[model samples]
Target: MASKGLATKRRQESGRRKGKEDGDKTRGGGGDEMKAGGGSSWAWKTKTENAKKVEALREIEQLEQKINNLDREKGVHLYNKRSDFRKLFCTLEEQELKLNSDRKTEKAKLRQQLNKMRGSVTKFQRELHNVKPTPEFVEKLKEIMETIESVVSEFKEQQKQIYEELLREEQTLNQEVTALEKRLESWASAPPITIETKSVKPKTVSSARNVIADLPPEVAAFERFLLQTGGHRGGWDEYDHGTFLRIRNKFKGKSAFLDEAATSIPGRNITDVRQHENWYQEYLTLMEKKKDGIQKWKIVKEAQKDECLTQAAVDEDEKKEEEEQKTRARARRLEEERREQADRLNAWKVQKELMKAKEEEKQIEIEMRRAKEYEKERLRQLEVRNQVQEYLQRKQEEDAIQRLEVESKKAVQEEEKKTMSREERVRFLERDQRRLEERLAKGKAKEEEQRKKSKRLERLKGQVEVQVERDPSRLYRLTEGWKERKKDTTSASNGPVLHMPHRAVPSWRAGL
Candidate 1:
């Protein structure tokens, strides 16, 4: 029994291990699809997975295409932005250039304006300087002003005369218009003829005034009462009446309706309310009678209205013809007046034009003469100015030459005095000392030679004296030769020789 149990246990353990291995194999092969009894499922899953993979790949491609499209759009957008920025920058640059040019132009204009103003100021100053403020000048100015004022006053007087004439013509036109308007009013005010229709009764009511006149005493009394009491000041107005009616209707079958109505009406007593109710009832009855009468009147009036309109039309046509004739006459008169005014204006214009032509000719001649004189003065001034400029230019050139010479001398002195280093200064001083020593030595040697020549001459003179004792002729020849030699030596010593001047060393250089 134990062996059977052990065998069963071992078999169970082996089966479990095998199952685990099978699971690992299946997982290693290809996941859940490789499990037992999964062939159809595996194929279906593979197909589905392939379809899903294809769909995923398609989605990824779509996404990639979208990304590429986005990138392309971004590139285009960036390019557009860059172009816009470039355009804007170019625009800004152009604006800046334009502004710079404008500013330069403005500066030039300002400079020109300043120059013009300066010239004007100078001219004015010169004029002021040349002017003499004399009584004669003042009197001339006053006379000129008076003459201008007189001319202006004369023009104003002529204008006043023209205005007076226009006012007279306007008054005449106004009077004629008033007469025409009065004639029209007279024609319009003529009484209209009454045409009685034989078909209807001639006694039918026509106007409200006739209706009132034909009303009974009771209706006249009612109308007078209504007029007296129906005002808003101390009466039951339409609003009060409406309120009273509304309250009365609301309280219709209840007690004390008049009191309620009076209360509801804002400002009315029971007595007034009762009277208003009575008047309203009587008004309703009167309105029915009035409506019947108005209907009868309307029928008669309508029949008469047609005939009256026909007569009125005929009368209007006649009036229109008369008005047309009047208007034509007025137009003819206006035309004639306008023609006369035009003739007068034409004559005035011609006269004014002739006067203006004369004035303008005189002014032009004066201006031309003044311009000629002014041009002569300007030429004279310009010539004088040119002469002055030439003289100033010549003086300036001479002064510049003198200044250049002075500046060159100063530059040389400054360089010599201030530009030397200690070593250079020592070198220059040593060189100068050497040249001075050389000059002194040459002078000393010349002095020694002159002294030696003097000694030799003395010796020769002594020898000549000794020889004179021996032979007078030989001594004389020797003395003559010595004299000639002395003359030659003196001449040679007096010959022109250049000497360098000694310079005094500055205190600073001496210290250095």
Candidate 2:
């Protein structure tokens, strides 16, 4: 019985070794080898544990294959999604480009319209500047000119009548002078007629008939002196003759003239008369009377001649002055007429210029108003364009921020996958998802805050624009304030901004 038991035990040990070898092969050797070197009971327990370990390793390998397949599928899906996102982004870019191009075209059309309006306004202004006066004012001026011409014609007719009358009078005077000259010539040429008559005793003519020839020598000499001293045609009057007679009477008793007479007479012998002092005195007195009378008559004649010449000169001067005055009056009237015509022409020109100026001013005012409206519209267009540009810039910034966040999350996921087991990796993914959610929430909150700030800024900008429109004087101040607020907001949030997945910033906020 002992021999039979030993053989059976050896057989059992061989079977156990064979099973250990199989288990080692299945468990990749180490655990099964340690169990094979141990006791029987421990070996049985190790075999079972090795079997379970082998099963678990097979299951793990199958699961790894599945995980690898899933990872490849996930990679393909992510690649396809990335491609779709790229295509979608390209499409959006194309659409945005098209929209921008359309906007540019619209802006150009608007500018063309504005330019055309400005050109029309300028043309209208030019036409206004060249405007003419109304026909009614021209007709009124023509009537005034016609009235002035009629008055001038009437004055010329009256002057011509006066000239004709003077010409007739001159002709009559010339004819009378000619007739008188002919009569005198005929009388001078008449033949002398001799008449025969009987001789008769002639009566002595009265001394007064030949008064000049019958006068005494001294008186004759005095009379000759008076005639020589007198003006042409015996200019001395009765008053002058009386003055000469009175002077002669005062010297009548003097005899100084007798001595002079004795020397002057050719055959006179007055020695005895010269010896008589009384007779000498009387003769001298008579001679002195004659001299005095001659001198007095000469003085009176000269004075009368001077008075007559003065009167004649005065009359001539007055006549000449009257003629000059008439000439001056005619010249003045002609000058006045010329001045009036010039004034009328200048007034017409001034009125025409004033009318043109008024028209130009009206046109200028219209042009200014149109220009102001155009400027306001242009400014509004510019503001819209600026808002669009700002919106585009902000969108670009948000897109860039989202791309950066996605890339960072992908890097973190790659790192977690590299370091963690599946379950740990899953926990890490969940944690990351949670963190991402929190970050997204925070980003959303920040975006909301930024949106609110932008909205506030927009409100402020609108208020500033309203103020600027209402009272342009405050434009500078409001603009400065807006700029300052914008700077403050920008400075306060100067850090990097993260974007959320769902929410989008408004275009107006981009403006802020």
Candidate 3:
């Protein structure tokens, strides 16, 4: 018995080992060996290091896969992706926010440059309001834009003509170059044609604009001044010799190409070719105006020095820039007023049309509602008509049933009457009483049958329905139910039902 038990235990152990092997093979590779010290149970140090290395490598691979899947160019998480729900939603919302200060400044600088060229101070300043510029700053900006506009307006037509002239010159030069190349080829055996590469210089709309852009922002304000005044370095390069010499004498130590050009000249008169045009004169005037404005601004600051700009009231020196602001504001106000006036006229016209349309729509709606109501009433009337028809059908069925009962009872009585004289009938009834009783019973039962049928219909129609036993065998079992019922109903015999009681007649009528 002990040997058999041992044998059984051995078999169970062997089966468990086989099952474990199958399960291990089915599940996966033995990667957990790495987690268990890289399968190096013998050496502690190597086991730890190898396991750490494997884990690090796996983490790096996962991160690389993630990075590759993501689009880095957009620099934000993709909302459409499902990889990481919370992180992606937050990142997308952050990216959708408006620009900060650095971006604001960049955009402002770009707009200032564009508007300087475009020459629309009113539009530019309105746009600039978001920049939180001071009243003084805004006024200065308008002044500068005005000057730039004046310069461009003066030179725009001339510049167009200059562009045309340059185009013609370019065409002539090209023709000359072609002709010379042909001649040179022909004259290879002869004397070479001395055609220098006479490339026509193109006319440029070179702006003091770019100068402001190029200048280190340490002197950015001055550069801005130059831009505003349309005073290109090229223009200043064409200054008079005497002024050039004087500037050289004053700023002897400055080490800029512009400074050198302005200061030093050879035998030629730099300004003789192109003196200060209205633009240069305007530049000087602009400088003076800027100086005056700055001085006044300083004075205003001084007056408000003890009394703060914000913590105190307005002072007299700020009055001028303020007046300029009011004037510009008034101009914009008038322009806006004109626009509003036109808008009002348009609004009035639209309102009249809308009113007319609304009136028409109201009438149409009212008519539609009335029509729908009329149609609904007609439908209700139709439903009532159908209900009346159903009632009439039910009444007709009841009347037919009543008539059938009356006719059947009358026939039974008449059949009995034809049998014999009353004394003979009585004698004959005594003999055939059981058969007559059955006939009367059946006839009486039929009367009760209708009443029972009506009661069943009322019960069935009135109550919530419950399913009934509907097997054919069950139905067959009830096949003779009506006949059986009829047999039980009548106690009629040859004795006079001489005056059928009212209660019996009523029950008869009810059955029918």
Candidate 4:
């Protein structure tokens, strides 16, 4: 039984062992299958991660390709733009350089022009510097310039006269026009059969008289001379004087235009001139008196100082006298009046010198004006003479041309008359030739005479212009001076007319 049990146990154990093996194998295989499934899941996760990475890589590659395409397309355009900017910069730099160069050139030219003008001024000054004037020279120069000024003034007067004539003409024309217009209006307003008689404007009569009643004797005499000889102006007939008098009559009373023109210079009246001179003389006299007073005061003060200096004398009597004298002369106030007078004198002297310098300058200016006028006159005369000569030459040439033509015509006619045996000739040819020659000769002589007359007229006109421009009165020429101390032998020539020395009402300051 023990033996049988052992065999069964062995078999059971063997079977058990076989079953365990089979189970082990099955478990191992199942475990292996599970592990394999787990590995597959892990691999699937890895594959998902790898797939995402691959997709990301593909996107990166596409992006890279796009970028490359953009770079290729844009690179050329950017390079071309940079090249254009570089060229433009260089061109701008060149233009800026050219402008700077041009500016420098212009500045140099302007500098040169300025330098040339300065040089001309210097030269003119140098030339004038060497010509020192003599004492008489200044006087002569003044005379000449004054003459020139006079001539200029005369021309203006003539121009004024011409203008006045024009005004008269214009007035006449307006009157005629007004008359014509009125006639037309009357014709238009009247009945068709009725003749209209237009009324004439009344002739205006001026109640004013020539204000020459208060004229000085000299002025009166000059007026008489003017009336008697018709001004004796070259080429001006007696009729011209009548014309002048008519024009002059128009401005009998004070006119604003004439007054303003006359008073352009400050205090520009004859009376003012005399007053200024008197004032200056009085000022000089006062200064002299002040100087003399100062001198006297200085002497007195010196005497007082000497007395003070002697106050320290030793002798008893002298000391007593010195003390008494020192008491009278106080050192602090001793020379006060003298010092005051001295200062006043110095101030006065400075003013006097200034006034003197001003007077001298005025005189100098007058002289220069006259000199310039004289030169101008001389030049004018030369020009006039040249013009006359030129005219005469031209006239002679015309006459010669006419004469030659006449001679040629005559010779031709004479030659042609051979055919007719001198039986007939053209009428009026010889008479006409003679008349033309006479006309030419007369014209030449008249031209020369007119030239001379023009000069005299110009000179007279110059005098009138200056006198009138200064005062616009006949009295401005010193023609009515009544202050002259008359001598019995005073001639009735071109001199100032004096009135009886009664009393002159003092003149008032202007703009008072």
Query: Best candidate, lDDT-wise?
Result: 1
Rank by lDDT (best first) = 1, 2, 3, 4
Per-candidate total of colliding backbone pairs: 0, 12, 2, 18
Better of 3 and 4 by lDDT: 3
**Best model number under TM-score:** 1
Estimate, for each residue in 101-177, the C-alpha lDDT of model 2 and write its tens digit.
65466446534544454454445445445556988655655665565556546645754674576455444444334
lDDT of 4 at 210: 28
The list of candidate 1 runs beyond 4 A from truth reads 1-225, 231-234, 251-256, 308-316, 323-512
Q: How much lDDT does each candidate structure score? A: 0.60, 0.56, 0.53, 0.52
Candidate no. 4 TM-score? 0.19
Q: How close is candidate 3 to the true structure, as a TM-score?
A: 0.19
* Backbone steric clashes in candidate 2, count: 12
> Which stretches of model 2 miss by more than 4 angstroms?
1-311, 314-321, 324-328, 331-335, 338-342, 345-349, 352-377, 383-390, 393-401, 404-408, 417-512
lDDT tens digits by residue: candidate 4, 1-512: 12223233333343344445445545444464566768676566556755765675576568657756654443333323333344434444454456546546644653454445445444544544566568665665566556555654664576467457655544444433443453345345533331111243533332112222222333333333433322233123345334433433555523332343234334345444333334434444544664565466456656765655444233446545665877666443336644764797799999999999999999999999999999999999999999999999999999999999999988986675566543333334766788999999999999999999999999998888553355467655443345363545457765685765864332321222
> How many steric clashes does model 3 contain?
2
What is the RMSD of candidate 4?
A: 70.8
